[model samples]
Target: MTQVAELPASAAEARDHVHALMATCPRPCGEDALTDALLIISELVTNAERHGGGMTGFRARVTEDHFDVTVEDASPAHPTLPGERPAGSVGGYGWHLVRRLATSVAVTPTARGKSIHVGLRLR
Candidate 1:
């Protein structure tokens, strides 16, 4: 397993990290996985920056069937659905989209903050 450990300054930076990893790593499924992986990374990093008080760490790795992305942030809050608000809300789309696209999602609280792990299956 090859893992890239990088704490990007922004979502763009995080995407660049993953993009570089894709160049060196073999694609288990294809381009679609790349697209999904990028989108997931973007959402995770962006959410951390906007709502979680900025991202603290980032890691991405590819296994035989899984492309996993882990992001750590300053906030300890777990992601929630937008439906908690009114029907028409601007927030929560990122969390919802991430859960919909990711094969697995996890939240772990740390001493400084929390880490969110999201995985996409390459099948």
Candidate 2:
């Protein structure tokens, strides 16, 4: 079974919510893994806010070997991985970071919006 939580656009609040939920996992998840998970959550939530037409909320689910985090918003357009980052690009690396940290990622259209889910393995 997995646990779930809904969160708003605030990155800090989303991170805190993820931390609290991850703490309940049966197998221990290291600090680094937790940090990565939170960072990915932040990226997803931020993207939803900045581009997804405003975030409806987010969900966090923990399984035996991974933490599944999903963020949903009002837009159907999914996030894309930028091919390259301009020399001094101030932003636009969220999806790239997520791809690096997560074991797997899935973006699917929902009834009302879209959900970007990242799976972070427990180590």
> Top model by TM-score, which number?
1
In the predicted model 1, the residue pairs found to clash are none
lDDT of 2 by residue, 1-123 (tens): 457676654988888888888888888788898889888988888888888898886778887678988788899986765666556657777888999999999888999898887888887
Query: Where does model 2 exceed 4 Å of error?
Result: 84-90
**TM-score of each candidate structure, all chains considered together:** 0.90, 0.85
Score candidate 2 by TM-score against the native: 0.85
lDDT scores for all predictions? Answer: 0.86, 0.83
Instruction: Put down candidate 1 lDDT per residue, 1-123, tens digits, no spaces.
Output: 668996888889889888777666664458888899999999999999998988888889877668899999999888778877688767888898999999999999999799999988977
Lowest summed lDDT window (length 10), candidate 2: 80-89
What TM-score quantifies how close candidate 1 is to the native fold? 0.90
Q: Candidate 1's error at 44, in angstroms? A: 0.3
User: After best superposition, candidate 2 residue 57: deviation in angstroms?
Assistant: 3.3
For candidate 2, the lDDT comes to 0.83
